[model samples]
Target chain A: MRELQLSLNQTQKVRLQRALEKLESLSSKANSNASVTVADSIPVNYEDGLLKGHGTSEFNGEVVATVCGIVERVNKLVYVRALRARYKPEVGDIIVGRVIEVAPKRWRVEINYSHDAVLMLSSMNLPDGIQRRRTALDELNMRSIFEENDVICAEVRGFQHDGLHLQARSQKYGKLGRGQLLTVPPYLVKRRKQHFHHLENYGIDLIIGCNGFIWVGEHVQVTDDMVVDQVNKSEQDDAKPDENSISPEDQGKNYTRQETRENICRAANAIRVLSTLGFNITVEVITETVDLSTSINVAIHEMLGSEFYVLVAEKESVRRSMTKKK
Target chain B: MEYVSPEGLRLDGRRPMEMRQIRAEIGVVAKAAGSALFEMGNTKVIAAVYGPREVQNRSQQLNDSALVRCEYTMANFSTGDRMRKPKGDRRSTEISLVIRQTMEACIMTHLMPRSQIDIFVQVLQADGGTRSACINAASLALADAGIPMRDLVTSCSAGYLNSTPLLDLNYIEDSAGGADVTLGILPKLDKVTLLQMDAKLSVETFENVMQLAIEGCKAVATYIREVLLENTKQLEYRRGI
Candidate 1:
């Protein structure tokens, strides 16, 4: 039996096993024997002028798999879809990364790819939301926007000779703060049409980076800062409080509400449970898991408990089987 | 002292040509890109592959191929006598180099340019043939990591003891001052990537010993393939449609 890190009681274990078995049954059988280990021969019709793709190579005049994955065929092309591998980035993928280095005119972001992606200051909209050329002074003040260890979200611009380049040209793609970042296997995060979700009901935001770095945080209105500045100036006439009267912490006046904070933690723990169960992390799946926990009155921390894992597993199995029936 | 008994069995009640039972488990290390634990009898090795990611040292970055790095360590309690061996000991360093070269031969480094792959293998239990066990574990981990390779590399150690070619030698036979031949091969390609021997053997006897080791390696390769296939299937189904 495959080991689940969580310790489960006898009944929980049985439930989990049954749910997993149901999932296995629900999956299609077309590619049942298409799984290949290292160096195993992938059956193909050589008469079709085959083109070998990634995770495969020519060995002894035979197309053999070089990785443990499922064989995927499309007309004359064949490739292996590897599981449990590092993130392979494609252009225009929304990814969350952590700033590792504040270099000259560029920031090196670790996006779980083969190399640290380079985010040039010129490529992103500055805090002022202006389209001016980046000056030497702007380079000097790069840390003001993204310094070392700051978590950021951006789009994959493209690959270059130096390394991968990222662009943050939109208001929503910039520094992410006051959030919990969860790292899961990249393969589990499928590239979908929408990676950013604003959970309106909970007043929380979920950013599912294609690189498998997920961010769950309080929702921030994605408005141009320049507009906000004008609004703040007009509101200043309404008798603003004196800055010196309050402590530095209170002066910022950016404390998150208790309800929103709880929602963030709840969403983060929901993601953790989905990752532990090795299920695909999507907005629908995550919201479903969160609702499941809330309906059962599972605490945020207790969502990782053994019984909760079993329940999630069972729920997922039932959900998948229902889809299969349709 | 005779290694083979009068009934043609070895010390541990196994035939001369028999191999130890093999067991493998994948996804043992959660943080690693790929990981596996392999056991050949009492020799247990856990391997974790961290990259095909950004190179840690910029100076060592290769332009055309990914840099391959390997580290081999054994726990103090793995041996009969608990000895605190410092890091980079001569024996471990040599073994690490051997494993790296063997793995590099099979890995398609050109596909991952400007990156580095790290393989770390630790011996938890050492009955004998830790080298072979470590190689098998690394192969499984690399495959699990989805690093492209020319073929899966499998290794085994055989010895010529009491004029018999013993497959999968035990610690007793290994330390008996007989010839120990460690062989690594690409089963599908029928090519040898690593061959090392300690002590001397006659040409005829060495041929027989090498052949026996090759057979053991092929057997290990088959088992490894089965384990990897099963793991891939499980991961696919678990991820759902």
Candidate 2:
């Protein structure tokens, strides 16, 4: 007949009525201590014999939440009584959050999970191109692509000892450039993550978060429409090359894989910027191995090989205008 | 004199001894094992029941029974002044104990020995009669959990103010009362499993107030019993071949 064996057992329940009768005699003597002053909280009779051995106990049968009563936050630290548990985060949860900081090559997203998510520029794949490096010019335009407060789509790339990394490499990811950013209570946001709206149509892409920072925006790219065309085409292909189709040089062991991946990485970040910026141009930066920097002119001219040719022509025109004085 | 002045009326303008409007629904939280929402006047309570899970502590594992636990919390804005923290309070703790104490008498604990059952009640608002509302709400949650119970437990506070005895006391009357009595009853058995009274009253008046409180609880139990019965009927209908 026994179901839950808490403090009020059969004896207790039956005894409660009798206890009340007895307690009546002591009522005048008992004091609620209304005159107590404010102070820090102190634990009172929260733990009975049952919950006392929690940390040391190896048994799974011990009921964790068996407390029936506790002290209130009284004048002086309410003699405390605790039985509740704390909440912790898990993996693969979608949370919405906001951008709080714009760091070099990374954005700090406050996802309300007590931790910031790093949306690194490297997470995004550059548009498909022969140019494998970003020049100085690209760095100047980087902030323009993802400003301090701009929201963006990203995936939980991986968590390292450093922090949680979010990536915008996929077509589904990147600068959620404009929108009314709504901040919701963290818990409500957690509850809403499971029922988030699909952004594919609003051309909206969401970060669906665990920390809560979210990005929503339409697509744009800075590279020429041709490069944008190639990036879109390459992404749509989603092609995984056959191992058999691998080049003989790459097939060999110790093929210096690390350097190639890093080289391609630079190009990838550049593509992320250009493709999102509405550039349809194909890669001309392949010839000169320029690195991305804060300077946009050097970045654009060096990466777009054709741009260098345009620069040369413009320089010759300037020279003719200067020598015509002779 | 009225428990509430005849001219002043109860906060909602009901006569003394009148219970506040109670709106209850079950199975509201999708993720909880069992959930129910009970709104007594404006004292809204949400309860979730989880149980029969493996008990993890070594010493608490009794060779013979499941454990019952209850946590009662009021949301910060539920009252006139905001509460900085939500959990771990004395009045809340006392209320929690009573809820646990009352529920233990009804649940069939032997069915799952060495296990535990948890009842978490969150008060979203307060006007008065919080304990009874929590009890009523927890009962629905337990029932929604498909747990076995001896009977539904309903609680309500009855008090005496001025000369009139009130059946359900709101915050104002309760604070201003000469005596406040809260009782939880097992309606079918006409048993009082949990009872607490503050302040004082004469013997005859105390008896009358207790009777009125029990009667109010019985009425609430009857209404909630019907709700559980209808719910079971619907569930059975869904599973019918």
Candidate 3:
């Protein structure tokens, strides 16, 4: 019932409930009592010299949880992993965020964190691919690079005194366009080795941000030739006044084919259904969902219908069971 | 009027020490970080918590702790009279301050510095003891948001009518011109965060009424803990390993 606000018929409701119950049963029984609410004492062997970590505090000489979460213990360290909380950034996390403000020499991005992350202009590679000091001219043209409200993919640079800082030095980490942005609870997104995925068959790109901002868009290859061409084009413009404001390459990239657009929507809808069903989202599951929808001939929009939600829930239960068997 | 029958039953057919039926639902507001709807008999309240995020006002940002803000409102149709009331009236503002102070005391604000947390509670049905209902709803919402807190806070109201101390006073009993006491406490820590009393009562009678309210709070706390634990288990199982 939490965020599963679907209008399902009686039969569909019964099916969904059954699927969810199966999922519950499939979960490991070892940690059934591991879940603790606020102020609940986390039983531990105090004689072992345990160190209290986040989401825990001392109360009456006993370790009490300060948040509602699962108790996690690692050797001498004891902590609680909170669910449904805001994104807690760690170094080297790939995140997608929207530019909230174009501050002086930096762009404040709303990355679903406690504070807007700061993406300094110096941290990112300029459009021209030059490795030189940032001049005043670069500051004036900051909007051209990342305008306000632009969705960008960057890495979490270590936090400074000001706040959390981000860097986008790689070509793959930059502004994203012609796509849909979906926001889910940060806890649902597990950090993995690969966050970026390019589905060759669908010709679409999927970015699973650690901060829970997902990007589903037309695939754009990150090649050095495009950077060289941009540098040459800028030189040409300086020598002779440009006849057309928009370049042919820019136009081609901006115009997404109908098939690719549909693929983007399909992938985005798949994520929406999975997140609502509270399933752990991964590339394998997303692709499987997409394949399931297409094989069944469900329209892109219908992927969000009540019937599909039930199907996905059932499919996930079956898939999880199969994995357990392995 | 005979508020309590000689047989010890109140008008609503409940004993003087018995509380109304309490119900709670989490994640009622889909958009909020944390939300809950709490009901105490006929009094219903919805609470939504947003934040532990960037402080909206730069000047108000705290260097060593998070700023907690609260707003309390009553729907025009919440009461029986259906009177249109202006926003931020004197009574509402006072109640807001009281709720904010009570919540701030339990929330571990120092853990989230330079951020602001906003708690919004609205009364859908104002039967009686709206203040206590709002406090309880806000506490649930905060816990749902995963905000760090020293302990879960629960509140309840008690009033003296016909020399009998009643728990969880309803609208009729609340307006009976008798002494009404609203108590908020961190049930796990066993510390009082808020206590408000209107009208006058003798020392002995005040103690009796306060004792009844404390017992009511402990009962509410047990129910809240059960709700939270159930919700946590649901979320955990759904997001299986």
Candidate 4:
């Protein structure tokens, strides 16, 4: 009963249990009892010149685990990969976070890590797309760019003396809006080559943050129009009489259709079910779950029902077994 | 009152050195990084651990180690007689301090520098030996949170009454005005991190009682290890390759 949060009938319960058992059998063959609890000794040959890594310590000339996790060995180095813990950031990883503080020249973001990540004003590309230095006026207007409590997407720049640093250089990395943010265990979100996915069919954007903060939002065409807008504004300042026409994109900014909202909900619920089942979350699996619900004609809200959960479980079992066969 | 019968059985039908049944469940709190509910007979405690994250108070952040904070509370309905208790009472403050110090001894604080870890344990049922139950629950929560520790710390209580040494004292025995010893130990390292006794006892008798408590702790440690290992495997296998 790993996830007993849902209420299921006897038949559904049996089916789900059987599916989970199959998953257990499938995974156990690959990593048979590689787990170690606190203080359990990890067997390592002394002739290899062992180098201990995180989550390990030496006790009485024996390497013992300091956490409950799977023992991972690479060459002569031994380490434990902990699950169900806070995000441990690495450089060049894409992450989603919420701004917690607006400091003098930086915004502190809560990225599900041990420390709040700092996004300095200078590290980000300003709206004008100019390469000028950050002036005092820009410092005063930092709130206009990203104020407190704004959900942001950024990259792990590096570690600073005080805390982790984040950068938002690309237009794809910025304020995320009109969507849902789902928090799962960070381990479930494996780092990938492309974290941003725009499902062309659903007209929705799915961002899989490395910190396990998943954003499901309506797809907005990636644009750097703010720089163009700034240039046009300065030009139009002197010729204000001829600035009557507005771009079609500016007029359609907040007009998300109701159907698109439903699509967003459907996709978000799909993610919810998969995360609850502890399945590996990739774009492919998420889209497949959504498609299953749609094909079965399950309502968006009913996707969380007991029957749908059982169906998802059975489907996952079939999917994994097929992959294993290949 | 004869606490131990002629048959060498306590009031609850357990032998002098026998402990009460223990049960543990992990991930009881959805929002916490780690959570566990542990029960020792009628004494039930729930523990939640948060962070190894940024310290809430900037001034209190440690430069080279994580700051460990603990708060212990007892619900009004947990006891037989419901009584309104003030927050931060003297007894609870003392117990919190004891639990914090015992936990800090085993946690590898230096690994998470400039962060703070918060441990909150509440008594759901207060039969007796609440201190020992709280310690065991906190240890499980810490392990579930994936926080590094030197060793798992397990605690148990032993008492001397009716000219016999008893393990895991009940409320009646605990309030009997006898010598009650609460011991916490790192079972793997064979090191004692905490020991507290209220009443007086002879040297030989104290040694015997302490030994009984340590044995109880080791038993509890074995149970906890089994629970953690099972939970870890479940998580691993569920998130399959």
> Which pairs of residues have clashing backbones in candidate 1?
none
Q: For candidate 4, list the clashing residue pairs, or say none.
A: none
Query: What TM-score does chain B get in every candidate?
Result: 0.99, 0.94, 0.99, 0.99
Clashes of each: 0, 64, 0, 0
Best by lDDT: 3
DockQ of each: 0.74, 0.01, 0.78, 0.76
Task: Report the C-alpha lDDT of model 3 over A24-90, residue by residue, as the tens digit.
Answer: 8888553657989999999999789999999999989999999998999999999999977988999
lDDT of 3: 0.93
Comparing 3 and 4 on DockQ, the stronger one: 3
- What is candidate 3's lDDT per residue for B83-186, written digit by digit as tens? 99899799999999999999999999999999999999999999999999999999999999999999999999999999999999999999988889999999
- Report lDDT (Cα) of residue B220, candidate 3: 97
Give the poorly placed runs of model 4, Cα more than 4 Å off.
Answer: A226-251
lDDT of 2 by residue, A176-203 (tens): 5433343321221233334233332223
> How close to the true structure is residue A175 of candidate 3, measured as C-alpha lDDT?
97
* Candidate 1 lDDT: 0.90
Query: Second chain of candidate 1: TM-score?
Result: 0.99
lDDT-based ranking, best first? Answer: 3, 4, 1, 2
Mark the 10 consecutive residues where model 1 chain B has the least summed lDDT. B232-241
TM-score of 1: 0.97
Which candidate should be chosen as best, given DockQ against the real structure? 3
Please give, for residues A79-192, the per-residue lDDT of candidate 1 as tens digits: 988876789899999999999999899999999998889999999999888889999999999989998999999999998887799999999999998879999878889998
